[model samples]
Target: MRTIPLITVSLLALAVLAAAGCNRQPTPTTGGEAKAPPAAATEAPRLDEHSYAEPDKVKTKDIALELNVDFDKKELSGSATYTLDWLDPKWGKLVLDTRDISIDKVVGERADGNWRDLTYVLAPTPDKILGTKLTIAAPERNKRIRITYHTSPNASGLQWLTPEMTEGKKTPFMFSQSQQIHARSWVPLQDTTMVRFTYTAHVTSPKDVMVLMSADNDPKAVRDGDYSFTMPQAIPSYLLAIAAGDLVFKPTGPRSGVWAEPAMAPKAANEFSDTEKMMETAEKLYGPYRWGRYDILVLPPSFPYGGMENPRLTFATPTAITGDKSLVSLIAHELSHSWSGNLVTFARARDAWLNEGFTTYVEMRIVEDLYGKERADMEKIVARNELKKEFTDANRDLQPLAVKEGVLKDPDDNLTGTVYTKGAWFAEFLENRFGREAFDAFLRGYFDHFAFQSITTEQFADYAKANLLDKYPGKVTQAEFDAWLHEPGIPATAPQVTSARFDAVDAVRKAYLDAGTLPTAATTSKWTTYEYVHFIEGLPEVMKPEQLAQIDGVFHFTGTPNGEIAQRWYPLAVRSGYTQANPAIAEFLTRIGRRKLIMPTYSALVKTPQGLQMAEQVFAKAKPGYHPITSGSVAQVIADAKSGKTQ
Candidate 1:
């Protein structure tokens, strides 16, 4: 998953959560504040708290899936046939995770290839976050089990968009965002990241639409109702994705391309044209691009996250196609995940830094290589500032890069800047301390050693100690290294990153703020999205109406096509009472469902009486088009404001 820059969605939530008084206890500090020793060289990992499946007992090895997409009912009826590996013969049951789903029956394959009905039970969940547990009585001799089920109309992982919600407005669209344990809502299996399984899928959709999955995709396949897919490589359930729509494909390179609605096919193809170059850059940094064909599927505006790194085909938000390729960092971030996340995975959500931090570090390296050091540096600075703003007293316990075993109440809680930005800073600290060449070699070795494996933070720590820390003893002490991991905030020794471009932009902003001086075309015309965001964010929290009008008139920020600029300028417009931008804000909010860009605008709007009315009115009309995740998040913001939790 790639988090957007400028401002994070969680930070906007934190702003509202502040008034509620976050009375939670903070995690214990390790290195800087308290000189504590690190854990023993290699400690055994605990079972995933977020998963009900006992992988040590019996794990899934592969799956054969058959499903029918019903647009009218807005449900997916499917049977997932699993090939199991009984790790311990004594274990007589196979447990899986599920949420808001209907199970017709489960059967086991006998020696003669005949299926025998198996006794199964659905256990109620104590914590809804983990979902329901499905346990099947499996005999030691049984190797194959099939589950016939249908997803709920309101499955959390799925977004069934009506025809009017799509770009073409002629055919309905359906897509899946299963990251962070949402897979259980659509497919019953071990939803934890601890286990991996290969899968083959047979899906039937509308004859007018096409289907795509994370598995191998035939770009030139016919747009028939039936589609078949095979994922030869083993992947966790979270990586299993599906989409069907009035889609068309255009190749950007021999191995790279995009799929989008006909109206967006050519534009999106042009926007992400550098995807092949990104793949080459990532391969040079790490190992080969293990996933066969690197393609991207650009979903409609209602897609939640910026991008999801689903093995072969990446699922992208329409917001990424800015016509200028200014937001391709999201692409780089997702592409690098082909190495850090898709190849080597995190065993649990608490150790998410292992996947995200490494990917952020590599993504920046790719950005620096493809764009320039200046662009990458500017991104780092913006991310750092956003992380600082996000870290509040209410969320102090959640600030550490390495979360405690039971700290995560919901998987979405892990989607904070701490895991993404703080983790990246830790990687950069290592790179700055040890030479880049040495660090690069260490990372290359790390990816190669752990390919196709799900590991815990302890495992990565052990590997790093043996390869990097122990190899260069005095360069980084064990205690200091522990600080970066166990500590609640950025370490004191973190490298101070600078960007000359941002400094120049700051000068222009300073003049404008101090003396109301208009920026000249020479400086303003060269500004990129990051530079514009920096300038807008640096403005005073409260400005005069005339000043707001002056900036909007000068820069045409009211309805800028650039999503990044709109996210920043809209909030400033709300805070400064720039009424001229209200219509544009409504259109932007209803059209773009990306949580990061829209949540902050809602957060700003909910603070005032008039703005709150506008927010509620707009959200009432827009909620139907949003994914469950996005709608739920924005609903909380509105509810919090109504209850005075946002005061």
Candidate 2:
């Protein structure tokens, strides 16, 4: 996730020094180094990361209280007050994790208290004394303690995050990514799993603009004009979110809606129509509609992850719009979080796959319901292919979902295909094994039992082992989970091919035969002597004659293309090869070229680099009302390459 370029992962060896110890306590830093950047000033406000856990909650059943965020055109108005439960009888120096954040007002129960600010590259060290530690003879279990302060916004090492643009200006999207404990970057609180607190956030923006947060609005979930909203949800500081933008809401899916502004709303809503069905399906499968109504708001181009599942409202990247919403599975991915993540949460980042992958596996239900199984498979395979491109044998720096919290070197990149794609694969594998009915029953049982609670990979594995072992006894074992999770590799189990209908070689060869003859599944399903003849005839002129000989009988090409293959192959014949290398390779190299004819191949070429590149080149040149046909992979490739590595 760091921009610093290195030839190989060798640089990661040095990276260990930056994050050596996860439990190192916070120590105050000299305030003179640099001032904390303001929170996303104009965009939605975010939740403080370290504020979620309540060490006192272990003994005192008091829930943590409201976070006050004011983004008025004044100073960065950031303040938090921890109102403890009145029942628990205990008191200690109040713990809050403040990163680049600064304190402006700290008013303990009686303004008689001491607080410390801590600083370390990896952890915050408490040092700044807040007033003096004077125990206000208030209830140790239930009492109000406010820590108010103003701080600027920061990239926080997550790059290109921004709110949707208004006119010529772009607002800053306010949200937090607490994956590896970056929550301390904003607020001060014990950033640990040992604490669980109820959160209510007050986000103030403009009088006309709407404010959305992690939870559906409490009784306070309602809006008071355009500028303010009170969201009541039992959110860990990490899941806290606020996105403020000029969003145009499209009310299509019965309480379920998709948001967009002038330029994006109409299309976004139209594209996200399936969201309604997904919302409905999720409710039926996952127990109740917890996030209230579902709303997906598209952020500006720079929005960090594909989607941020901030409880009720999801923050998604506009870059995925694809004009037609052709790639909106991200919408479903986020929605499933309502159950997998927002409900059955993860205790730490190490087992994050539970949150992300669970959402992915269930996401198929959402997509398949609306988009049909075939299209879902088509899109998923395309995504998987993109994931494959990022790995170089998939073993370097690999860690399981059991990884410690806030410790992964590159947190942003950690949500790789490994978790997203492979995790989805694991889910799919389970579904295929158990059959949809049993899988759904198991998932529902899991969510209903664990809803509103945190779950670990180990816990889930235990659950799976107990339940799945009856039929799949010993198959879904700790060993199976360790191999799939704790260890670095893809799950070795393969899905049973019911019919054994498809052949990769046959598919590739028939594609060649059907080059001029538009291929049908039947023609491309068999690899025989005749198919070889079709391939030779369809082979590109640039292909070397010898290369043709190497794969002469193989019928399919590998990454290691022989000189003969490369030379004789025309870029068009195989460049955007996914479905058209005669038997294409999912590629995005060439979006539709300057010539619109290439546009016809847009859908077919979507999963390849060449197709995406071509689309980008073509889009760079606008011929009026013409939307660029670039694929998601091209955009990502450009980002990864610019960031200095392929993955």
Candidate 3:
């Protein structure tokens, strides 16, 4: 396990102190006289300690970006000019985060509005995760600073693809995924969630390609190799996203649409036909959608995460185009983030549960409202089972939802089933205890109060106590809240989730287990993807290869096009030594790059010597198509196996 360096900790402490001092309220003057304070004195709450930026000294209010996209060099070369709002000019310097970026020059505006070259220093590398700190000398009354820089070949946030990797095999593609601290690799800024700034950009791309961003986007207009954008809403740096490729768009509704490669745009539009309804449902539940239009861009199969909740436009995976709308729950999940994550963000990755868990709860509600209660209940039951399996693995490194204070070194480690599943369970518990109407009102009010702000777990608790618990004293107790939020593992009061459809599937699984016989196809002819997943997951862990063959012959799980079903079944086939499923497993591993499917299948393959060799061979061919985040995770699994460590 890795830890933060001592020097980084010291710098972070200084930044926290500076922020606290800057935020202190002004004192009353003597003889009943009062002095007006600077506008920056009433600073937004600084709750994030994961960043090295001292925003109290000098803060950025807006950003102006000018960049050129060179696919041949696989680089984004540009200059970022930031409008600064200073609090304490005597600090004399500004620090920003950078990784794998080449700086050409740093210049600042003087008090008399003249640009002057400024001396800057890139601090020594601290750790692979934290990157380096770029410090620039500042003039006494400087209001703007510009850094001319370009990204390196190994920038983690970027993924440059050849024509062969794209759906339309005629043009190349380039996309960015910059969440959870990867934004520093491509852009130098105060890369922290505590800071929010509006931005405008001028992007110059190839004549044949179209560019899109997380800002106001126009799909029908064609530009002469140059484009401009504006995002009026102040957003965190992680939501900064850009993509360029041979793309086309089709409107799904008045205020919603879908974008994809020209070859897949129509199919994607049809698959996501209900996106407008989802937005409307979410707004009715919470509040109005603050972002102007809600649209989705379906990337190629190599996208690592299920969905990234970029403010106006979401970056999605092609796996969600399952034709049957069974997988649109993922879209609902991302749309829920418009309220939970995009509007009100968690201060740091350590408090990710506040973003993910609340979104999960909201996702289920929206699904139930549009679809049905049975579908929603089935999803929750599956999630609960997955959480139990994670607990049974008993890995101390993978901590529970409410992890201990200061024990976390890397925020990515908190992205676990505990945070997502058990966190949703906590919300569900509250809803069940206090009644749906009351819980809904409370959530709407919570989002209203903290809109466009970064928050912490402790602050959330305080607000909940004052708003809900204090008003109705006998509904729930403080100890119960503490146990749910601070204690490890699921509390004893976890809400019970049940689904009749899953219960029927479980009975079929039990019948097969007890009698050692395969069921007829007629028994499951009317099942949906969720029912099939439940049936597959309920299979015995150590079934004989012959039994697996019998099951496959009847259900044809190996050739299923649905990524979720194949992901669950392939790992089971690998563990059972079913040689017949090898080709399908190889194709699945190589073609799809989602971490949820890739990690489990590869981890299962590396358990034996023969399986380890197969895993390596498949990975060699698939490595080029995978995003950096996916490849990094798969490499670690192989390394652990080589070191005789169980994954």
* lDDT string, candidate 2, 218-291, tens digits: 32233443333345555555665555545556775667776655577877777777777777777777667776
- Which stretches in model 3 have alpha-carbon errors above 4 Å? 1-49, 392-400
Task: Tell me the tens digit of each residue's lDDT in model 1 across 377-455.
Answer: 9999999988988888878777787788777888788746888999999999999888899999999999999999999
RMSD of 2: 12.4
List the global CA lDDT of all models: 0.86, 0.50, 0.82
Against the true structure, what is each candidate's TM-score? 0.92, 0.63, 0.91
RMSD, one per candidate, in order: 11.3, 12.4, 8.1
> Residue 217, candidate 2: how far off, in angstroms?
5.6
Taking the tens digit of each residue's C-alpha lDDT, what string does model 3 give over 343-426? 999877777888899999999999999999999999998888887777754554444555655656766667467678878888
Q: What's the candidate order when arranged by decreasing TM-score?
A: 1, 3, 2
lDDT of the structure predicted as candidate 2? 0.50
Candidate that beats the other on TM-score, 1 or 2, i.e. the better one = 1
lDDT score for residue 530 of model 1: 94
Q: Can you rank all candidates by lDDT, best first?
A: 1, 3, 2
The candidate, 1 or 3, that scores higher on lDDT is: 1
